[model samples]
Target: MEGKRVMAITGVHHAQITIPRGAEEQGRQYYCHLLGLPEIEKPESLKGRGGFWLQVGDRQVHVGTEDGVERSSTKAHLAYHVTDIMAWRQRLQEHGFQILDGVPIPGYERFETRDPFGNRLEFIQPLA
Candidate 1:
């Protein structure tokens, strides 16, 4: 409380999600090939642990490998802001990713869905 100053928080640098062990290729196919997020090389030290990183806009998403945990049935999730809410809904639905409607928020249109691994994801677009 004295002369100390509080540090201001900045934007997110990265977020992490997990997949079943030895399923990195599947993750890559869904996240990269289908979703269009570019794959970025993993750091040398973190390579042996499995999984890889992807570039989402200016931020990064790290997909890790783990097992036995319930990837679904959790509230923890990542929400990505997009330009077209309807198009994203259609595209993901075409691939059979079930669409879950998000709660109504004033001035926004959004929806939720799961990745192939069952990680909850939200896609939102601002309504002007």
Candidate 2:
């Protein structure tokens, strides 16, 4: 077994989203309180930065503050599924989130919203 490749299986341990300056608290509020994800405590080595890290089920979301990059396409947004799509939409609307009425994307109900730093995100639910 020494110096040989083994046939084992593993999956993605995490995913990350980088935001620009001053968006940490907003990201926390949205991902933690609003979306109900558990806030993963950052290691002491990664603290004192201008962003946050959050955990969603088995995945992780890392929000880092960039210096001067311009925000671009919303097409690369993250798509999340919820138990009640309409209710989620309403809740976001009630919180002043800019909701975009998206076209039917073949097999799912979808909508889009922008984060505090202008990063776009999507939410979709499959019709059952």
Give TM-scores for every candidate, taking all chains together and pairing residue i with residue i.
0.92, 0.80
User: Compared with the true structure, what per-residue lDDT tens digits does model 1 show for residues 1-128?
Assistant: 58988898788899999999999999988999988899999989999999999999899999999999797989899998999789999999999999999899999999999999889999999997
Candidate 1: lDDT of 54?
94
- Backbone clash count for every predicted candidate, in the order shown: 0, 0
- lDDT by residue for model 2 over 10-68, one digit each (tens)? 88676667776777777788778887878878899888876787776677778788867
Whole-model lDDT, model 2: 0.78
Model 2 misplaced stretches (Cα beyond 4 Å): 1-9, 72-74
Cα error of candidate 2 at position 43, Å: 1.8
Q: After superposition, how far is residue 39 of candidate 2 from its true place, in Å?
A: 0.9
Please report the TM-score between candidate 1 and the true structure.
0.92
Residue 42, candidate 1: alpha-carbon lDDT: 92
- Candidate 1: lDDT over CA atoms? 0.93
